[model samples]
Target: MFLPFSRYLAFALLSIHETVCTELGTSPFNLRPFSINLSSGVRTMLNKIKTTELPHFPEYPGVGSSFGIDLNTLKSLRKEWLTSFDWGKEQDSMNQFNHFEATIEDLTIHFIHEKSSDPDAIPLLLLHGWPGSFLEFLPVIDQLVQTATTSLGKSISFDVIVPSLPGFVFSSPPPANWTVHDTARVFNTLMTDVLGYSTFAVHGTDFGVGPGYALYDEFNKTTRAAHFVFLPFYPLKPDALQALNITLSPLEKFEEQEFIQWDSSGSGYFLEQSTKPNTLGLALYDTPVGQLAWIGEKFISWSDPHAGTGGSVLDSNEILRSVSLYYLTRSFISSLYIYAQNPHGFATEYTKAHTNAPMLFSAFKYNVAFWPPALAEKVGNLVLYRNHESGGHFPGLENPSALIEDLREIGTYWTT
Candidate 1:
């Protein structure tokens, strides 16, 4: 369990020289301070997984519904999409950026590595979460690149890297018992060893929030800082009014109130996934509509109904496409496994596997239902904290510009 610090630095440097800089397009100002090769033991451990296709989870009847929206809405959305939305056109638009895959812990991890036109542009590791994909950040990435190039200058572009979580879309499944922490380590290897980033800022949204924090914990040892759309720890403050600042507008508040009242509420998915993920995942993997509905519910429920309510946010179509990645990868099960394996209240036997390094945390007002910012600060040595009037669960997709700005600020002040 004791990952040698020496090995860790070596893996990072190996990434910096052989993979990160050359691949990413610039060398850090100084690497003489760090080693750049993996220790033999670390190399042996890293080589353990033999890459292979995941077992073909046979599709089952009613399984497709697992991804599609509720039957009634699914019908309407399907009509709209079939008659209007264009995948071929969309594919070309996405191809404007770079995409690559590298073997990490036996899985072929997929990522979009868009180096900014800016040579001095900061390297950023952007992660997407469950029921989502790398595509979630595409809109934000586009804006960041444009802003950096036009406003900041050509050398101000982001050397951005967005990766699909293992077992989700493009990326291969976890061969055996991979957890979020393990995934974080794999990403560490990817960013440092495969991509050659000696230091980089990490950002994530949704479930990506957890691994993002984990990666920051890992990367902060040699890199800069970490930012997340969702922070898990919740702290109760004295002011009831302060905590009552819900993201819902008057109409939306009525909708959510009705939702909480009528629907069986409060993250039933979390309960199921945390307890019996495989059983539910079996059904979700087969029922695309079911999967879509499950994910769609979160999209509609999580974001601001009117985009302007908070920082500019993702519209409905963008959310759906992000969900589609999970379906295409048939990763509903593997992704849910992170929940089942969560060690939050579990014994040290499982918990001691990873480090809980101090993090620079931000809890968007909308994301507080799960991990309120005041509560999050209690868990770690919180170095940075902020509360936004807007921004819901999926911040990257919701308010990319604001998220990017916050990230740039964190990089400027904390990366040193």
Candidate 2:
């Protein structure tokens, strides 16, 4: 009787241990010596989560027509990547900018911490969004530094910090229940604690937009100001706006149209990212061609369709370079995990939070999303709402001179 009871207890403990390890993306059947001692009680609480399967890209009639790049050309380009691309060369190019990492709370954040040789440089934080790394802003750094020098004076250059967002490239994934706000806090530490800057200006677009504001909130007293290419659709709760007697103007009506378009057309990536990133990550992780196509679809839509915007909206060379970073680092899944396990209600919470600081917005016309000047004013101060005749999401990359000039003008108003 004693032997049978002991065997039953051992089996129960093994089951529990397996459950716990599987839940956390680890294998439980390791033959390692360390597996022998875990208490049955500790393992019982763990639940296994099944990773979902990603979807197939359905062949569409006009998909290739969007970029004017024929199927044959794309096929050949992909072949070249498999045969000729050098990730080592690309890695070296990325390292050309100074690199630094800082641990804040639960994260080890990787960033390009480029301090201008000019001693009087202003500290500027540049944040990148999903599918973007520090390299996204590389093409335009010179222009930005120049703008800072000219507007803030030669003595006033900019020390720029561009971090890989949590779950992106070099940064680690979020802790158990972390949200974008949590990511923002880490960034604040980087700014205030690590870099030792009491005040700095900030800029971001896409998923990076929200954190940019959080940085402003974190540095409420001293952060000079914040700027974003993508602005949140405010008054998060539809019912609340009705209760508050909020009203939007004619321009607001037009901006709403753009917002609706974004939701309808620009949201496929959002849906997949927020709900099933892990599943998609599997495909991206295993096949480089699949990863390129996954990212290539977005590159076409976001950049000028004609490729006129910053070298074909994205060059074949650049896509491979970007994808290579994901592949070599083996970060595709971990990075995508940020979207999968993002804190459940952070976006809603952020948009609806009660903050009295008036907002300043610059809405570009061709951006995938933007608030019409009228709607933005209704939401906040909307200090600068200018429509560009050209340029899209990657404004700085697409039209550097125009973006620099605009930033210079916007700088004068905010810096004072």
Candidate 3:
């Protein structure tokens, strides 16, 4: 029942969705305001999909899902999406956040600005990375607004702001050469100039680490403290490590080996997106089934293996929501531009904060990359580092409770 729309049909559907949304006032990028939802036409098309038509290929011998997305799992997920997934429910949940748009450099920035009623609540910028939208942090917003207490009974809470990274859902696409450093400047403006916060905190993961680090480094005066579940450091190859005479402990060896294996095997997305994203985007962005396989594979391969939701930790519902947003906003291709615009890919250069802001990092066991504390220390003032046996790259989705606690704990050291 799985069929890819012809490239023309796929792009047409994409264009229709965008055009229809624009015409209906569902997604107005004029910077006034906007709401998010899958159009009725698109929903009908999705519901009418023939999942059973997907050609069944024999599963690869022994490799299973290690090589790519498992067709069987994808079929099951697609069926679930077509038959049982509820976009309205997900959209309602997202609407619970105070969403607003602000124009920055001619780009309309969409963000969730949820302030805790507590007057003393700390302002924290929660940034999401690629293949993820503001949806990544929705699960933890309720918890973040609650009073967070320390062992001493001292309490804290957060006024959370989650922005759709430029070119992401609801946010207008960026101009060429828009690096995360540029994003960092825009975000600072959002927090300071637009939101009118004199001091704030930050938490980042994946590509989010770029802007989060820039705010932590370049705007140390306003960015009081920061936290991260991932960083942007480039992993040195085995030869490079040997050349530097770098010694690895047994655990570091295991981690480094995992990284090497990922670089050799799992880095096609990075290379393709960085070098020739338009081709990749043209091929997949407009097709729902194609989008499913492309994004769905990452959710499968990059998540904690022993966890639930078909080994992805989070459920297919979230995956479907991701696919839906990418489709409705026609943002998949533009989202990849972050990679194309910042062609250095990961980093040989580590971020150094100019001020002594407390930086907390949570090292999730299943995350795609691991930088030991020694190297990570070079990136900032490493005040709090927690090693977790659970979670992965999308910790906000995979382990929201853990991510929430990490965010909560960051406040304890805010003034230290």
Q: What do the candidate models score in CA lDDT, each in turn?
A: 0.57, 0.58, 0.78
TM-score list, all predictions: 0.69, 0.71, 0.86
lDDT of 1 at 377: 49
Candidate 1 lDDT, 329-348, residue by residue in tens: 55778877767666451121
Model 1 misses residue 26 by how many Å?
19
Order of models, best TM-score first: 3, 2, 1
lDDT leaderboard ranking? 3, 2, 1
lDDT of 3: 0.78
Off by over 4 Å in 2: 1-76, 83-86, 147-156, 234-259, 308-313, 342-360, 378-381, 414-416
* lDDT assessment of candidate 1: 0.57
- Higher lDDT: candidate 1 or 3? 3
Candidate 1's TM-score: 0.69
Candidate 2: pairs in clash: 121-157, 167-335, 307-312
lDDT of 2 by residue, 1-416 (tens): 12234233433454454466558756422211111111231212111001212223425545653443345545655666656655556665565555555566757677766555555566778887767777677766655554353344533456677888887777777675666677777788777766667777777776776677666655565456666666544322324444656555555444445556666666677778788877888866756556666675565566644445433234667777776666555677776665666535233333322334435556554566655444455433345555665565666555556555544443444452
Model 2: ten consecutive residues of lowest lDDT: 41-50
lDDT of 3 by residue, 324-414 (tens): 8887788889998999888774778766679899988887767778776666788788977777666777888888877888788777787
